[model samples]
Target: MTISMDQQQTLGLSPNTLKGVHHIALNVKDMATSRHFYGAVLGLHELTGDEVPETLVTLVAQGKVANFRLPDGTILDLFGEPDLDAPHADPKQQFTRANHMAFDIAPELFDQAVAMLHQQQVPIDHGPVSRPTGRGIYFYDPDGFLLEIRCDP
Candidate 1:
């Protein structure tokens, strides 16, 4: 899957133009539950004031948006919409399960994460198994969005 310089030039590709993810926005069923899950269970910091974009806040009603900061400075924005009808993909198929967010944790905290998930009663959809990347687990959020926690060592 390596592309030569000529090929890259022919495709008008520019190196280093694309940056990593800035934020990920999701629509949730319950604001309180989602806030607790991301802010408490996962231990992410919730942003306030000008930290959130004015456009995103105005898209919905007031106080419907909650933004959580990841350890790597990526923002996870949650929109509270009680009647959201988002479709969840089945994890059995490869492509279907491709649409997921995977977060990395320290290798030592991997076991502790599993324990927390268990204590919280979140059902694991796939694994806490070893992969090319690391040990990981697939689980669903309260709103049925697929999420993964991987420990790279």
Candidate 2:
């Protein structure tokens, strides 16, 4: 993935803009469960994350591709691989939720998500920390994957 400086410039690339994320395809033990968490609870509609493709959608996104397009142009790509070993959910097993993939949210919603997750009996590790950039809260996903809801200053 290494690119020379001249090649990078020719691609209209800069360190920062290219630094932004495109999308993250997560490995899920079950797609249905993930859809319930990501789509139903989190409010991300499935652009396609289904086994059976709809007639019209296939007509639009092309008749062949099956990808879930989220509202923010971000695809909530889900993979159902029962054979994949789940990563260690314990923080001691890893550090910085960034290693897993932090799902940043609005600072205002951090408390709400925490309370909701708590009510649902989900595990939360850290506080609503305020960084020089913004605020964040850390928690674990269904598979014990660490995630963060953050807001930039």
Candidate 1 has a TM-score of 0.47
Give the clash total for candidate 2. Answer: 1
Best of the candidates, TM-score = 1
lDDT tens digits by residue: candidate 2, 1-153 = 787979746544233322233334466565567667886787776665343334235432543222365676654455555565546766367532222345555555556656666665668778668766566666788877766655555
Model 2 poorest ten-residue lDDT run: 13-22
- At residue 86, candidate 2 shows an lDDT of 49
Prediction RMSDs, each to the true structure: 17.1, 17.9
Total clashing residue pairs per candidate? 0, 1
Where model 1 places Cα greater than 4 Å from the true spot, the runs are 1-9, 57-61, 85-153
